[model samples]
Target: MDNLVSVSLRERGGRFHAVFYDPDRGQKWRTLRTSDRREANKRIRIAEDLVSRGDFDPWESPIPDRYATLRGAADLYLAEREKGQLSRNTIRSDRSALGGLCSHMGPAAKVRAVTSDRVKLYFRELIDDECADSTLRTYHTRFKHFFEWCRRERLVRRNPLDGVPRPAVSDALPRFLSHAEFDALVGAVYSDAEAKARGVVDGERSKHTSLHDGDIVWLAEVFFVAVETGLRRGELCAMEWSWVDMASRSIWVPANRRTYSDKDSFGPKSRRSRRVPFGAGSGTEAVLQRLHDETGGKSGPVFVGQRGGPLDGDYVSKRFKEYAGQAGLSEDYVFHTLRHTCASWLVMAGRHLVEVKEILGHASIDTTVRWYAHLDPTRLNAAADATFGRNGDRLRQARCGGR
Candidate 1:
């Protein structure tokens, strides 16, 4: 490997000639020629300084011998992440957050040139204006990650967020489905007409070939899978004929499938990759198997759009609402309601708090407890009893301890 900053010269016709060298294993570096060795040396010095300062990647060309654009700096940051075997889903998530910054901050803004005050103000306004906590956290996480990238690349002299504090949020349980509810959701809830309409499927869902009969049975199955499996919309969409292993009875979560969110208009949710364990005989996998048997199983997305792409989640939400209305379920319920329902069911089943935490991918148990604490009064009561010696004893103990 050749050092990008090393000075090297090739003489043309015995006259002095020089150019900056960038090593490529499978390709040759192209040089921009300079006439004078002294000028060439100056150019080399600037190039080396710029590269050292993280103005550009060591291998990238067209690097300005000056400040790098936020876009350019981002490229360098992302390139390293890509090389590190980071999942595509994770990369996309980070990319969305970081790209949103460049888009909002302006393309010309240099990561190195960005000041502390500007960043502070940016977050301040986001919080003060009452942007959703989740949304603000996304920005903060992305910004901190970008700054960390700068630190790694040596683009910034110091971390911009060193003094900044991330907003604290109480860990709340995510909603999922209950067993009974999931059973009801996947059973014969959808009608022949509604399923025939291919409710949630975007124009992309129609690729399964024309259906002559009711697929409500299949739709019901799909709803169960969503709630039971906790698979995101994109994961559901990207599933293909081969990913399903009926004998093993688990649907393989493909790392390459597109995310179902409209945040980027269309595509995978992130580059983060993981295979989910889908069970056999009941819940989601059963519905998937039924669909597989009907469609030839050799075609495109499992949940094809009306246009033959994966079903858009937004459409799913609307369709779920319609189904709920028809079934007289509450209106406040959304597609996400299934997720909540699942969590509720887990708590109801007396699953360990840690087990629920892992199942939901929650970073903390406090999150799980927050949502399911109502269901586990005994656990809290037990803890309270340990600390204060039962309800009445706690009152007496408090009076004595205070005295």
Candidate 2:
């Protein structure tokens, strides 16, 4: 056999070993199958010849063609998702969760290499980093869906997430602004606009655009409409002049205006379209009329940027936070808090869950109940009185000698 540079022999425990440099396994040192020195040398030469021929792959267990890296499978999964009717928001969330996983486990790490233990550890790290349990649960769901897809695609032998437990999320009620805080926020918004108009507040600009007097006033109007009609921020931004019916005193939330993108128009979160009527003497009609007049009855978006383009959601959220803070609201206050506030106030005012659900354009009544059920203690109390009140009173009289 020809001499090989990377092959050598070593004596250990009275046995001759053939040691060779394997590009894949780093270095291979194995006892020769034969005890004879000539046989061990021959084996070493054969290994070296394979290495030189570029045909040696020393991986003990070879990866199958079905195995895919996390990143590779995610690309396939997301491509599949995009081809379907999945919302852009859902796809964005999936991408975000996939990014996190790719960061934790190397992007090139095989999907089959992931185990339940790794998933548990990843969540542990997230919790340690102070990620909310709710957020962790979202991550868990994204991973679950990804793994399920991988299993169906045969990219993984089995779902690594099978035995992994979902992170427990709290059933805490959504936060909403109080009546006093709501009033304060409104005042702050209007007052800020007035100040900017009067030159008292000068050169106050947002990252996206300048906060003009009209923009501020429009935002205030948006706030009022949000409180009255329970429209989401994106919905408000997507609202067109044509959707408003002054004669009928109603606003149509078209199914097409749900998404918030760089486009001129987008769709709503709920794919279904519905109408929200201005309540009898709710004064919401007046707010819409004034907004229409203030914006010069534009044919396009009711709320626009300084350049009269589609309103930037981030700008609105930033201004909302600025005004909310000035109102002395809690730090956790966000634009969505207004929607929560609307539902809470409705429930407190004795509106039915179904009514709130319709106003909010929720897909189901259960969603409305889960968020606002705690606000309706009166209704629950009434039910309790109807079901157990008399029976409990009789039992109490029996125990207390009718005292």
Candidate 3:
């Protein structure tokens, strides 16, 4: 019925401005501060809505200019994420990446001022600093998300990272421990536990190693479960007793569970649930039983720290490195290597790729194949035998004249 708000392009700098009529202040116009016609139109709708509600303020810009700064936008984005369902580790990672970006490009830099060339330059500097390809990819992804948020909020006309190509990362095969190495690592855990019980001074023990015999057993079980079930460190740390079924020898990783304020929350990386089974004699059942007994058969986390709280993922990794070192394993080995070791062992044991995919909770079979298909040669050999092998056998018979 009425032309409540309209957007017009200013002739001076080609910037779009909002022109609106205010009942209290009579006819009024305010700059939308956006050059893009589409963004300006969106802001005009916002202004119309504000006017209809009788809260229009001509002096104050509809879009807060303060949030246009890179630092301000990043902080707002992070604060919003912190209030959402994202995992703490994920929020921490976003904070770290955004902090790096703000440091690299002066914090006061305007979000709209970021250009593709500037982003490329930042990446180039990162490359010069010898940042790993994976790390570079992480930074790129974080920046892309941040810019997308800015675009959605109308803080920027468009995402600056739209034209930038993602860094190419090498497809390195997953590393795994050999059987001998695995045995040695497990033996080292037991040895360390015994040493601690005997009060023997070992120079190689990590200063953080305050594990008693029970703690040592718990750590060993953590290693066994990680290598056998292929659970991620966070999943293992947040694993609850209810998720494990000793009778079925299965661990149910659930995507949805009621999270109490007193408990740490856990969700799989894929955000999907899957069951991981362990063999009867794999010692997994025994390990779970022992832990169950020690934890008083309560309905709480399966693994806990010295303070009877959820295990810290970082601390588990640190202790794993020390144990790996004591076992004379390669320095490159980390807790995730145990997951790789699990998949490798499963594939080598003739488990199907799809089965390994489900066991490892991989979102796709392609990922399971990419990491472990090569480890299982039986299927490849069988296929070759079914095709070329038959032909070769017939050719050999003909050549020898049925001798």
Per-candidate TM-scores read: 0.58, 0.72, 0.80
Among all candidates shown, the one with the greatest TM-score: 3
Model 3 per-residue lDDT tens digits across residues 1-403: 1354443434235667666554554655666655557756776777666655656655465544456788888877887786679776677789988888788889688887789998899899988998888888988898899889788667888888898999986788889999899888888889888887666658454545465787586788888889989998878887888888888899999886333224345577677999999888886777888878877656888876767777878778998999899999999899999999999998999888988999988888888988899887889998888888778878988989967
Which should have the higher lDDT, number 2 or number 3? 3
Q: Model 2: which residue pairs collide?
A: 256-267, 257-266, 257-267, 257-268, 258-266, 258-267, 258-268, 259-267
Give the alpha carbon lDDT tens digit for every residue of 258-278 in model 2: 444563234666688989878
Q: Look at candidate 1 and tell me the lDDT of residue 130.
A: 79
Candidate 3 CA-lDDT value: 0.79
Cα deviation at 49, candidate 3, in Å, is 21
lDDT of 1 by residue, 11-95 (tens): 5643333345445433323232333466446656665666667675445554354326778778757766765544465688788
lDDT, residue 253, candidate 3? 90
Best by lDDT: 3
Supply every candidate's count of residue pairs whose N, Cα or C atoms clash at under 3 angstroms.
38, 8, 0
